[model samples]
Target: MRVALLSDCYLPRLGGIEVQVHDLARSLRQAGHEAVVVTATQGPDEPIDDVPVERLAIPLPGGVPVNPLAPPKVRRLLLDGGFDVAHVHMGVVSPFAMDSMRVALGVGIPTVATWHCVLAHAAPLVDAAGYVERWADRGAELTAVSQVAAAPLRRMSGGAPVSVLPNGIDVARWSPGPRPEASTGSLRVVTAMRLALRKRPLDLVKVVARARELAPGADLRLEILGEGPQRRRLEAWSARHGAQEWLSLPGRVTREELHRRYLASDVYVAPAELEAFGIAALEARASGLPVVGPRRSGITEFVADGRDGLLVDDDEQFAQALARLATDADLRDRLGAYARSTPVRQDWGEVVAQTVQAYGRARA
Candidate 1:
């Protein structure tokens, strides 16, 4: 089955969705299926790693690197050959999705779309009523990354069932490995996320600062991973909040380096007020580290409070949870030990099988 995977974000952009799309497409190809990626082009002669890429015409605000448009030739090819499946990622009623849908439906192609971003975060981009009507009209099988992602997506489905599929990690690539790096005397707690406002990287800063005051002797050091526009602001805040001495800002890590960092760190902390699903936290858990994150939204589906990890509500509770993990090595070890035991959505192999199955379904 020839399957086309479409996403707004891809490699070099650096985000959870982008990473997920790349991994999923790669897994699909490895499984012997033709999985091609259709993404918004960054610009002329953009270096897109090794993936096969086609450019779209979507405009970006301030010429930001987002290309969410579709070219006619790609559309003609998708329609002419009748792609078994058009698996779209995180597309709402946006122009890109609308254009893609025109080609999909014109060729009598069955489409499956995965909801990646949390609905609340996507409110500004999607037209709720128009989106639902369009989604229902488009006639596509819908799947969401988690139950948290499923809720808001339910509205768009009308009466269609939304499959709760998880975004998977390449277990072999993202597992706990090496002898692990020592955080010196500090019980290392790391937060790996883009420095975006919605990600609330500042929340990590605030929580780390508070933890320093509450649990000074714990020798806590927080590694803020990933890069974005807010790097300077986060660094400045770390200084002003007195977490500078121990807080390290290591911007952006590759897949290999990220997994290594996970192994090195004792705990993974995410202060995102809104998280579609905590992929970073999952990677951390896969690397045998307990996670500290919020209770509400998609994160709860993976993070079981007091079990694999601790889930809190606000900044105050986030600080408390980190402090608890920092002070109790035995408990952190216990949680980390069990953290890896939690089942994930797609173990590369399963992702392959399910994707092929979706292609079959699309054909039928």
Candidate 2:
């Protein structure tokens, strides 16, 4: 089967959608399918990792990944590519992806549109716009990365069913490893995410600080990975909380480094309430670390409360959970062992199968 992945973002612009779309294409090709990425992201048109990429990027200032004038080009590409399915990946505000979906449907191609971001707050506006209804009327199949992401879509889709098409991980790549003995005697807690307000990096820092206070005798150190605009604010907040020594924001690191850190860390924290899918937390879970995350987030898809990790209701509960894990070695060990021993169902093989199922539905 030949599939064209339509997205507003792609490789060289590191993001959730970009990475997932790239990995999906790679996995599709590995599964003996011809997959090509059709994106608006400004990058080299060269094939990445043997997967073909067609960039319809408009060179705006700051390399923004949006091309208002790419409709004609996108139409031509789809009409000529002989693609069996035009799989469109969308975020909350993906004009290019929506346009591509319209073009694909207009040309009578099977199109599967997947939403990668949470749309709770924007559902009303999107429903009012009636795009989802129109797409449904035109025989387009819709899906989302998780149940949390699918909820809003279900409402705005005008009774059109929205299925879950989760992001996948390389299980063996992040499988449990022998954790190195701690030399500092501090509980190494880690989180990997862009330091943005939506991710609530500062909020996580505060929760960790409160956890330290709740378990003063238990030494806890937090190292946040990834970089964004909130670095200065997070640093200043940590200083104000007098947590500079224990809380470290190491900015962005390579994927291998992240995997290594997860192996070394004792626990993972993901405090984002609006998280559509917790990819970082999944990686940590795959690496045998117990996770502490919001109960209402997409992390619930994997991290079971008191099983793989502790799910909290609010910041106070989040801090309490962290403190409990820090002081109670038995609980932490049990959860970590469970997390490590269990395999995540959202592996590439299962995800590819699910993608094929969606494509089949779109073709029908």
Candidate 3:
């Protein structure tokens, strides 16, 4: 089967959806299917992992990098490329993805639309848009990364099923290794995420500060990997709370470096409450690191409370979890051991099989 994985962004742009799109294409090929990536984000016309990437020249309005004129080209691709299925990954408000779905459906091509974001506050708008898109392509298969992300779309789907397809990670690549020895006596907490408002990087700093206050003499250090618009603000917050000395922002690193960082750290923390699927938390667990984060988000799918990791409901609870993990090495070791033993559903082959099943349903 030939599949076209459509997205608003692709390689050269580091994002969860972009990575998933690329991985999905590679997995599809590994499953004996031809796959291609059709994205609006500009990049060289080169094959990544042997899967061809088609980067369209799209317009950016008000600095929002999306192609307004993507529908025509998408329709042309569907009609000309002889693709067996069109799998469109939808962003929060992606015109290109939506347009691609519309064009694929209009041209009588099987289409699968995967929702990858949890629009917590802007759900009404998303519902409205989803309603219009569903009306436009009622036969298209709809999916979400998690149940929380599927709620609004489910309402828009009337009585139709909304499949839950969580993101997959390369388990072997993220497997546990010999943990790097900690140089400092302090507990090392690591978090990798974009420093965006939704990720709450500033709140993480505050949580680290609170943990210090709770632990008193127990030393704790935080290393945040990744960069975004909130870098300056997060730095300022760390300085204001006298946490600059203990907190280090190393920006972004390669995948190998990320795995090394996870092995080097004592614990992993995810502050994002709106994560559709927490890939970083999954990687942390695969790396033998116990995870600490809110109980309400998608990370709960993998991180079992008190087993693989600790789940909290509020900032104070988050701080207390950190404090406990920082002060107690035995508990950390036990949790970390359990985290390593626990198996997460991240096999790329399984993900591809499920995706092919969705494509078959779409074609039916």
Point to the candidate with the largest TM-score.
Answer: 2
Candidate 1 Cα deviation (angstroms), residue 204:
1.2
Compared with the true structure, what per-residue lDDT tens digits does model 2 show for residues 1-364?
9999999988999888898999999999999999999999999889999989999998899889999999999999999999999999999999899899889999999999999888877888998999987898899999988888888888878798999999998888888898977533357899999988999998898888898889998899999999999999998887786888898888899989999999989999999998999988888888888889988899988888989999899999999998888888888878978987898888899999999999999999
Candidate 1 least-lDDT 10 residues = 62-71
**Once superposed on the true structure, which residue ranges of model 3 sit more than 4 Å away at CA?**
59-64, 129-137, 180-186
Judged by whole-model lDDT over C-alpha atoms, candidate 3 comes out at 0.85
lDDT of each: 0.72, 0.90, 0.85
Steric collisions counted per model: 2, 0, 0
Which pairs clash (backbone N, Cα, C closer than 3 Å) in model 1? 40-67, 58-69
Order of quality (TM-score): 2, 3, 1
Q: What range of 10 consecutive residues in model 2 has the weakest lDDT sum?
A: 179-188
Q: List runs of model 2 lying over 4 Å from the truth.
A: 181-186
RMSD (Cα, Å) for all candidates, in order, is 3.2, 1.5, 2.2
Total clashing pairs in model 3? 0
Report the candidate with higher TM-score, 1 versus 3: 3
